[model samples]
Target: MQQTADRFPLSPRLFSFNYGRDSSAQTGCSVLDAAFKRYFSILFPEFTKDEFFDAWSEPKSFVVTVSVKSRGCDGYPDEDSDESYNLGVGDGQAVLRSVSVWGALRGLESLSQLVYQDDYGSYFINKTEIVDFPRFAYRGLLLDSSRHYLPLHAILKTLGAFHPFTHIYTQSDVKRVIEHARMRGIRVVPEFDSPGHTQSWGRGSVPSGTFGPLDPTVDSTYQFMERLLKEVKIVFPDSYLHLGGDEVSFSCWQSNPNVRKFMEKMGFGKDFTKLESFYMESIMNLTAALNRTSIVWQDVFDYHERPRSRYVVEVWKQGCYLCEMRRVTKAGLKVVLAAPFYLDLPIPTHSWARYYNVRPLAFLVLEIWKSEHYQTELSKMTKAGHRVLLSAPWYINHISYGQDWRNSYAVQPQNFSGTEEQKKLVIGGEVAMWGEYVDATNLTPRLWPRACAAAERLWSNEQLTLNADLAFPRLKEFRCELLRRGIQAEPLFVGHCKHEYDGL
Candidate 1:
């Protein structure tokens, strides 16, 4: 039984799963584990995963093995896996308890949400008893390093930063972010952007003038990325990788007439968009060969001039809504919203409220493949049945000098205009740390306890309000709480935006 929000439910039982059959991860794919444990202790102030698992995973018991898939409270059975979840059975009736790859990972993330201590997010589990999988074969989060050129450490830090806020990846920290997600069951997709957003990915801090193609055409670049991806993939094995492909400054191609000529010789004509599609197809093939999905940003739409059903276009800005997602959705492509959740663009109180309300599909469409229609894009998507996910960017560039960029989370709940029940529809949010001004040295501080606020808002119940008056005082306790957990947040300031917002 799920506790209904971010709170972990007291389950008398706990089960287990493996990576396609490997052992459970003990440590270090993300800082997420620490984030979860820290928050769990604060909320519950007691109880441990060890204690719960000890009782839940007990060997011999009556359990329900499923032969059919349970329908949504509608009682219609669907197909499912007979995979066992280990609920210790006592009487003829079985107490639903068990963990699979999806459930366990999500629980790890949910624990980080920390809405309530005792109910650390277990209620989300619904044992349907059938094998489930993602509808879209490919799902991913593309972290742009080209723009800010973040290091390996930053990438790891990003995964850690997003842990609690997203069920995209989890493994204890003691609860799961994906619990609610996995209960409904979704895939955990992660991405590492390079080349285009790679102005920052080159050697030393990318010099201002040194931006160009991420060397999708270079072998050396592949070698560098190969080692990086191999290491990070274990932390996120949902089998998708987002190769960021939006707004790539075509300077490299434009500067080198030979590069343009090369495209024309290759039958792509003289269009730079064709050149971009060449890059997309090339990467997709490489990733697909590795058994992963080629998730990219939206520029690929114009790049390929093909209806890419397999591609996942994560919309980064307003241009995406106007250009990509709307057209792509109409063309039968899957997508995710990254607009409203731009965590970097900090606007004190309800700034996120607008973002939270920024729906992924277009409320009205202007054109698609030469057709015109005023259609709700998201409805079309859900109707055509394409997969979707939520992305909230908390990159440092948009953050202020001393403001707890992490504290920006304090704004998320205010972002949602719904009842506790409706908040559940918010699959979850991601705390993205785009690497423009941040590096390993200053990264962690830029993303701590305050970031935890966003984490909590994403996974926890909507019970918390977005009142600065109430939160300002609590922010002190929370910041200290994070420091205690080894994360330091900037000191809290009440209505510091008064000078700015009050004037507005």
Candidate 2:
């Protein structure tokens, strides 16, 4: 991003939007059209009826032109899709161009961020040129709907603020959530945690007499999983699915006579890990048959000797996270790191610096998660040739007084000890908001400005966004922008926005 000394005044009553030939053809696209209108309203929220009529009637007005190279848009964004964009704001007009519609959406977001209102109530923009792209392809947020049911409108508002991967519980409104996500160029990867979180599945999914984790020894278990996953594949068009293989309490399986009998017959005695392996492998094969990849918790790789390479491992345990990362990547499996960024654990105010200071690959040779031998670990993983997603920085559900967003903004995925090539393997990061204590009532205020910080870190260049101090005013303004858009974002400090929220 480059900025010059030049400034241009903008008038809400005399501003118009235009599209290039390719993008003009996309005007009929509901996603693009709706987004444009949404941003327009956000930019001019208080415009009167007369002002709107004057702006619509004006022939000579400042115009922003959007162009995309792709003729048609995809139903959903995928891993290989391009989200890079070039935005230029200068002269009499602004031009936004991208290779795909997804990039155009990002560019439009940047454009909206650039516009500001002055003390005199006049709109203005600085002369700026931004060539922006996500460092990682899969920047996302993970919301857990299992512990507590989140309302549909709250979920929609969340999607409006950030791209997310929803961990669906039994009560989620799946189809409506997916439809809303699709229109915003966001992919909804549904997580159906099984074999452990199956407490929710016991009512109708399993035999009435039995209730708990699916019995690995029974054919009925696999049958139920097949039917459930089949429906999931149809409902979620995304190519990836999260088959949670975490926190299995073996007591339930141990207590079952059938499971014990099957284990002994298979020459496996008291090895609960083996039972878990069997369950996960069957599910993975089922997912493959459905032509979708599976993502599981790190336990799948930790307990098994030869887990399949096609699946992704999410490392969320606190102790020895780097060791887990090395083990998973060395085995030629991709990983998503969720070890350090657990938002559910509350900390002191201004603790965001600790969150921000965590580099994905840096260590001090300590006994804890960060190790001094980071380079050696990174070199080995680079040879293995796989990318990793990070979920280590932003966990908004854990509340604190004062500005906690700075902590979220401080985390840099590539800030660790490694070569440029090794750093490139750090694909992207996600901010998780688990549902243990959070629900529809507090979801929006809890996630907004904090998650917004993570969003910028993932989307913008790290070098350009390293300074937290520089970002203060900008984020303060963005908080106001979100409020005007009806997000109900919490205040940053003991201050107020120029336009107060009316709680509509």
Candidate 3:
């Protein structure tokens, strides 16, 4: 049988040529059993719920066996850890096994994606044996809820479509997003930006004629953050929490009387960046005490007296990516690359290709190649043995009205040049859909299909990316599959393909 599995984000780690007719036998996973039923029922609504259930409840159905290595596998699945699984399909039976139920959950989703209907409407699965694990532990998408509050339903939809995504602000919304994401093996890391990006937080709290940054000098500021984080920590159980530490305009800190006094008392002496560092360190310490690891933007590492390895720094500085990366990694800090992956920036066409070509470690290597002097120091600093997460082909914000912009579906995240050792430093990448102009209603279409490109890049083999001729067609089919499954992913270019394997 010609393999349809090749069309997925990350094709199964292994598979054979054998194939079997797809059966509605009860899936091993109860969660996915319901999901499959809902999926097919929506597509083939002519069948009643009983009819659908009967089809799934038949003998020799899919077998889901989870081998839990730890406690609490049944509750909310944690995305901060491993999500690997082994799947075997052949010999008249399909077996899915994982160390944790979380892996089983991901396996079920992969199985569902593998099933495609023929023109005659029969579903089939390719026989395969596979072991799969994410390259980077942190494959994520960041939605800026602080910029535009995504409706609760929209956030849930995005979570459903994008398995692991975060960056949230609204208290009530974060609770709901976390609950839904947990069910789907997605971790919702709530980012209530502190000391900066607090325009919205400052609306009702601060007095007139003042800027939005939280006042580090005031004891009340710490109290407010303590209360907020206490509430947040309870709602979000993910180990990594993002406390945005980017872009705190010093004028605001300088102007505040209490802040100035506090800085002077601490002997900071006219350096607001020091005050920024103090604020971040305080919050990091707080979250650490609360049993949560803090993730801050790269700026915090620069201002602080000494970098702490405990915090995960997301490097997003424009024009200083390599410099910042080297600094953070040399400090022994784990880093995620958000600079090259900003999806909000507008690139003319083939945007996915642009994202795919970026390599996290190549920057320093190229610099070293260009200059003979810094090779030794650059090598040591660049390869700090840290895993990197990428965010690319950011959201375009506006829908493409008529044209399916070329290259939207060409995302290949592994496009980079480096020695094998240096390249191995990459773990995975994320597709960011910042909510500056997005909401629950429109965010799905904006993210889908295009984000699928990043998904495939992060999951699939790099060899597949080399041949766009093959990757493009597979990606088109993947997008349609997502749409058929009720995800609102937009088309690659212009008109939609009507069938599951159209234009292939």
Candidate 4:
């Protein structure tokens, strides 16, 4: 018989059998055994810690043995490392083996889904074999803390829900998160969105009265940025930092006399657009000085005469996504897609279907392109080389009465009609839980099983998306499982775990 609950992002390959009896989770490594004990304790909070330890240590009818090639924590997810694992169960014992600790962590998560509580309250797993690995290297979730700061505890809770990377804020919070992420094999990337998105910044700095985008004309602006980047480098060791450069209102700079004077001095004309570009180029230089890659919104293309190929531009404008993709790739730059992925929009109904229809690489060059030149550029992006990250279920905090769209399990990132080569250009997608309407109390449920939808889409094969009936039940179970482990991720339909696990 097939596995009773085949989950979403269904394994690249899986086979099932009817095991006559249940089995225990077994591991020879003390560290691995302790980890499973902790996991089981969370899943069965009604049981004492000692009971979990004994159960994990002793073999029952259903046994799972996990063996990793290496046994050290990686402090960060090795995006390029092999995250593939093989799980096999026969004759009452199951084996989970991976070449890396990261893969082992993934396998453990999969195994947890395989085992579930029956109506009689006993836990069991049908005999199964699963070999799995993620299709994309960078499966991330971009949470904006600048708009509305997320507290440390809330941040930790969000981390537990399987976001591989998030744009972190607060210098003091970095060490706490880094320590936690290391144990979970998640990496924390920081975004100090400079030049623009600085309205929240500059409380104690020069250009005293000015607010909003950084005054690009001020010499002190660069000094302030350098100081901030210096602090950010010390806190976040991730390879990339986002220097936000989108939706900048140049009216502030255009009206400021001092800014105009500085712009003229720097050889830029009176146009504030050039100042925006100049600021981005200078910030990219600063990021390089700190030995880090810079990520920015695509608007930098509007003013920057020649954007560096190394910077990763996040394409966020919905109306002109294809145009931006062509421009970025034609200039030999990388891009991440956030247009169709904005999760903040209000979806009072059928939200899952909306997110499910998003195809990251399905843009029609002939229709979106204004000219033959634009078409040629699009072709170049497809053939030459380009990769993008998709954020389908964008701002998760916004919800209506009844079912919250944020919890929908329909974020199909690969719903494109492109050829296989074109589809390959999609690096992965994110759950952009922008904080404009989110905070401590609401962030977890806002992102939970909803973000996991994106997670499975990024990690699992494309085949699962073809059939929603097959994926939804597993998604519901996954959400309940998360609840079982003390995650207050709100319910999708309307039911509670038979045994509630309380208090994160």
- Candidate of highest lDDT: 2
User: What are the root-mean-square deviations of the candidates from the true structure over C-alphas?
Assistant: 12.1, 4.3, 7.4, 7.0
Per-candidate local distance difference test: 0.40, 0.69, 0.55, 0.58
Cα lDDT over the full model 2: 0.69
Q: Give the TM-score comparing model 4 with the true structure, all chains together.
A: 0.80
What is residue 230's positional error in candidate 1, in angstroms?
A: 8.3
TM-score-superior candidate, 1 or 4: 4
Candidate 3's C-alpha runs over 4 A off are 1-46, 49-71, 160-174, 204-209, 319-324, 360-428, 461-469, 499-504
Q: Write the per-residue lDDT of candidate 3 for residues 26-50, one digit (tens) a residue.
A: 2354444444444344434334434
3 against 4, candidate with superior lDDT: 4
Candidate 2's TM-score reads 0.88
Candidate no. 1 TM-score: 0.52
Better of 3 and 4 by TM-score: 4
- Model 4, 323-393: lDDT tens digits are 44454455444445554455555666745544444343555543444222222222233333444443323
Question: What is the alpha-carbon lDDT for the whole of candidate 3?
Answer: 0.55
Output the lDDT of residue 48, model 3. Answer: 46
Q: TM-score: which is higher, 2 or 4?
A: 2
**Best-to-worst ranking by lDDT:** 2, 4, 3, 1
* Model 2, residue 501: C-alpha shift (Å): 2.6
User: Between prediction 2 and prediction 3, which has the larger lDDT?
Assistant: 2
Worst 10 residues of 1 by lDDT: 70-79
